[model samples]
Target: MDTSKVSSLEELKDLDMDFINDIGWAKVMWDSLQACLKKSFLNWVDTVLTMSQNEDDVKEWRSTFMEQFEDRCYELVTDIRELHEQVLVNIEKYLNKTQVLCKMLQADMPVIGQHKLGLYQEQFQLKRQMRELEQMVEARTSEVNQLRSKQLELCKNLGREPILIKDHPLPSLNEISDLKKHIEQLEQETFDRLEKFTTVKGELIEIINLLGYTPSTQFELAVITGEESDFKITEENMESLDLFLYNMKKELNNVKEEIYQLRTKIEQLWNMLDVDFVEREEFRKKYVGDSLNTLEALRLELKRCESLKRANIKVFVDRLRQELVEIWKLCHCSESVRYEFRFFDSDTYTEDLLELHEVQLKKWKIYAEENKDIIALLNKHHTLWDKMIELEQNATGADRYNNRGGKLLKEEKERNLLSKQIPKIEANLLDLAERYQLRYGVPFLTFGNTIESYINNLHANRENAKKLKLSARKLQKEATAINPSTSHMTSKRILTDCPSTDPKKYKYTPRKVFTEPKKNPKQLQVPKILLTTLSKSKRLSVERKKRLDKIRRLSRQKETRDSSTYIEFQNDLSNRVDLRSTINVAVDNETVVKENFKSPARQRGTTPKSVGKKSPNLPNKLTAVKSQIKLIF
Candidate 1:
C-alpha cells in the first residue's frame, strides 16, 4: 500500500490497506490524546484570557476607525490605479515624442536645420519621463503583490477551523491491549471495594443491640431482681413478661398454620412433624405439665401455631418488599437490596466509600460553581477580544496610511531640493541659449515667466486643498451631530414626501399643506323645546327634563294602575303645570267650546233647536250652570 504519491482515486484501495496496517487503531488512540491536549490547551488559554482586562477596554471609535481605514484603502487603491494609467500615458507620450524627434533628426541631419535642436531637447525630456515611469511601475507592482497576498491570507483564515493536533504519533497493538487490561483491572478493583460494604450490616446490628436495653421484659427483670446475688431480677418488669409470652404464643400459632399448609401442598408432613415434635414436647412440659398426654396435646397446638406463623411471616415480607419498591421509586433511587447482595463485604471498603462520597459531593459542587463563573468570564473576554482585534486592525491600517504619507512628504521634499538646483541649471541653459541667439542673429528664448506662473499655481492649489479639508471636517461634524436625532424619523420623512421629487429637499423645506386636516362632524344634537338656539348648558337641561318626563309617561302607560287614581293624577299634573310665559295673554275674543247631540225624539224628526234668547242675569246664571256642567263632565 503506497500513500506517498496518491494522485488517483483508485489509489484509495492501497491507502485503505495502509490505513489498516498503520493508522486504523492508532488513529483512535491518537484522536483521544489529541482531544485531551486540545482540552488542556483551551482551558489554559481561557484561564489566561479570562484573567486579563486588556481586551475589555476597546474604545468606541474602533468601528468608525475601521470604516475610515477601509475607505482610505479604497482611495489609495484608486489613486494607485490612476497613477498607473498616468504612467502608461506618460510612457506613450514619451515614446511618441521620441518617434517625432527621430523623424525630425532624419529630416535635417545632413543640413542641421532649426528643427534638429528642438527635437534633441524634446528627446532628452522624454527619456527622463520614461525613467520616472519605470521606477513608479516597479514600486506599484511590489505594493500590489504585497496587498494581494495579505488579502488572500485574510480570506483563507475567515472561517477556518483550528487544527487541534500539532504533532501526534501512532499507537501499537500492545498499547491498546494494555489499556484494555488496565480497564478490566480497574473494574475488578471496583468490585472488590464494593464487596467490602457487608461490614455495614454488622455495624447496624451493633447499633440496634446498643438500644435494646428494655427493663420492662420479665427475662431482663429476672436477671436484675433474683434473690441470689448472681440473679438479676426487677419486680417492676414482671407484668411485661406475661405480654411478651402471649405475643410469642400468637406468633408460634401463626407459623404452625403456615407449616401445615406447606405440608399439605408438598406432601412433606413427616419432615415437618420431625422438626416440630421434640420442640413442641419440651415447650408443653415446660409450660403446661410433664404428663405424656398433656405434652401430646400441646405439641399438636404448637405445630398448628408454627405453620400459621410461617405463612403470616411470608405474606408480611412480600408486602414489605412491595412497599420498599414504591418508596425506592418515590425517592428516585435504586433499591438498597442491590447493595446488600452486591456491595456488602466484611471489610472497611463500604465505610470508606460513604466517607468519600460525603467529602467529594462538597468538592464537586464547589468546582462546578467555579467552572460556571470561569465560563462566564471567558464569554465576556471573547467579546472584548473580538472588539479589540477589530480596533487593532484599524489602527494598523491607519499607521500604514501615515507611513505612505510620510514617504510622499519625503519625496516631495527631495523634489523641492532638486527644484532649488534647477535655477542654476536654467541660468546656464539661458546663457547657452543667448550665445546661440547671438551666433545665429535671433531673439533669446524665455522660460522664467512660465516657472513663476507654475509656482503661483502650486501655492493656490495648496491653499484650496487646505480650505477643502477644513470644510469637509466641518460637514462631517455637523452630519454626526444630526445623525443620532435624524435616524428615527428618516423612514417617516421618506413616506410622507412625494416619490417624484428629490429627497434632499425634504431635509430643508418640509412639505406643507394649505388646508388643515378634516375632522369628524360633531355628534347629532338632542331635541330641545325652549328655543331655536340655546346655550349648551340650557339645552342640555331642557333635553334632560323632556327625557325624564317622556320616561315617566311611558312607565305609567306600561303599568296596570287603578283607572280612577290614574285619571286624578293626570288631572293634577295638567293643573299643576309650571311653564313660564314670555308674554301676557289678552282675551280679545272669547269662544266657549260645546258638545251637543240629538235627542231620541229629535232623531225621528231630524231637527235641532238653540237656547239663546235670554236676559243678562239669566245669561250669567246659565254661564255659571254651564261652568258647573263643564267641570262635572
Candidate 2:
C-alpha cells in the first residue's frame, strides 16, 4: 500500500504474491505482475540513461564555470597588486610631505618664541623707562616748587611785588635768553649804582670826621681831609652810612650855632672896646685911628660870615639831596616819585643876607620836623621788630629747668600775645606806608622785609584753608547725595564707643524663636469626646461676615466720595466754560455797540450801560445758570 518507497524493478519483482495466489485469478495476477515488471525495467533503463546525460552536461558546465572563475581571480590578483603599488606610492608621498611639514614647524617654533621673548623684553624696558620718566618729572616738579618758594621769599625781602610762579609757564629758550640779557643789564646798573653810592658815602664819612673841631678849624680840616680822602666804601660798608650822615648833620648844626655865638661875642667885645655909639665921624675923631680899623675889621667879619653861610647852605642842600636820592633808590620808589624828584635842582639864595638866613632857618626847621617824625617811626618799627625777634629766639632756645611752671606759663602767654599783635602791627605798618605814599607822593616806613614775609605766609595759609574747606564741602555734598541714610549711621557709630571685636559679642544679631518640636501622628493622643465636641465653625463664620461687612462699607464710602468729587469737577468745568463764553460775548457786544454808535455822545451813553449791565453781571449770571443746569442733570 506504501508504493512511494519502491523505485527499482528488482524491488518490484521481490514483492510477496500470497494474497493473489489464494484468489481464483492468481495466474492472471502473476502474469500481470510480470508484464508490469518488464515495463518498469524498461522505464528504469531510460531514466538512468537520461540522468547520465544530464550529469555529463552538468559536469561540463561546472568545469567551464570553474575555468572562467580561475581567469577572473587571476585578473583580480593582478589588478589588486597594481592598486597596492599605487597605494604604496601615495603613502610614500604623504610621508614625505608630512616630514617636510614637521621639519618646517620644528624650524619655526624657536624663531617665533625668540620673537615673542624679544617683544616681552622690549615691553619691560619701555615700562622701566616710563617709570624713570615719571620719577624725573616728579623730582623736577618738586624742585620747581622749592625754587618758587625761594623766589617768593626773595621778593618779600627785597620789598618788591612778588612774581606769581603758578601763573607763568616754564621758561623757553627765547625767554631764558632774554632773561639772561636783562640780568646782565641789571648787574651792570647795580655796579654803577654801587660805585656812585660808595663815592658819596666816603665823602660823607670824611665830612663827618672833620665835624669834631670848631667851625673855623672844621673848614680847614675838611679842606685838608678832602684832598687826602682816598677811602673806598663798598656795598658791605654802606649799611651804617645813613646813621653816620644823620649824626654828622646834627654835629655840623651845633658847630655852626657855636660859631655864630662866638662871632656875636667878638662883635660885642669890639663894640665895648670902641667908642662907636656916637656918630661915625665923631667916634673916629674921639677914639683916634683905632675906631676906623675896628669898623673895617667888623665889615670884613660880616662879609666872611655871609660867605660862610652861603657855602654851608649850599653844601647842606647838596648833601641832603644826595641822601634823599640814595634813600629813594634803596626803597625802590614808584615811577611817580622818581619822576617828581628827578630834577631837584634849586636856585642859589641871592637876596638880603638876613632874608637868606631866615630862609635857611625855615628850611632847617622843616627838615628837622620831618626827620623827627621819620626817626620816631623808625624807632617804633625797630622796637616791634626787636620784640618779634626776641620772641622767636626765646621760642627756639632751650627750655629752662628752674621755675619751669611760672616761666612756661609766662612764655606761653607772651608767645600767644605776640602772635596776636604781630599781624595787627604788620597790617598797621603796611597801611601807614600806603597812606604816606598817597599823601606825600613818596614811600615812608616801607622798610621792614620780615613783615612782608609774614603777611605772605598768612595769605597762603588762608588760601590753603579755604581750599580745604571747599574740598570738605564738596565731599560732604557727594556723601549726602550718594547715601543720605549711611551718613547718619556713620555719624552714630562715630559718636558711640568702638564696637567689640570678639566674635561672641555681636553689635547686632537677629532674634531667635524657640519653636516646639512637631508631634508625630502616632504620638498625638486626641480624646474622642473632645473631637466630637469641637465647634469653632460658627465663630469663624461670624468673623468672616464681619470682615466682609467692613470691606463693603469701605468700598461704599469710596464710591460715594468718588461720585461727589466727579460731580463737583463737572460743575466747576461747566461754570468755567460758561464764564469764558459770557466774557467773550460781552467783548463782542461792546465792539458791536461801538460800531453801531460811532458818534462820541452816543458811544459814551451806550458804553456806561454796556459796562454796567453786561460786564459786571455776565459772569455771575453764567455761573448761576451753570449751577442750575448742573442741579437738573
Q: lDDT: which candidate is best?
A: 2
TM-score list, all predictions? 0.12, 0.19
Residue range 284-378, candidate 2, lDDT tens digits = 35432212234345456556555555555554455455555555544433345544543445455333433433444455456446545443444
The regions of model 1 sitting more than 4 angstroms off are 1-120, 159-556, 560-633
Best by TM-score: 2
- lDDT per prediction? 0.36, 0.43
Give the per-residue lDDT of model 1 (tens digit) for 177-250. 45445445544543443333223223323332433323455554453344333321122222343344444445
State model 1's lDDT. 0.36
After superposition, candidate 2 runs with Cα above 4 Å error: 1-303, 309-379, 399-410, 430-434, 437-445, 448-633
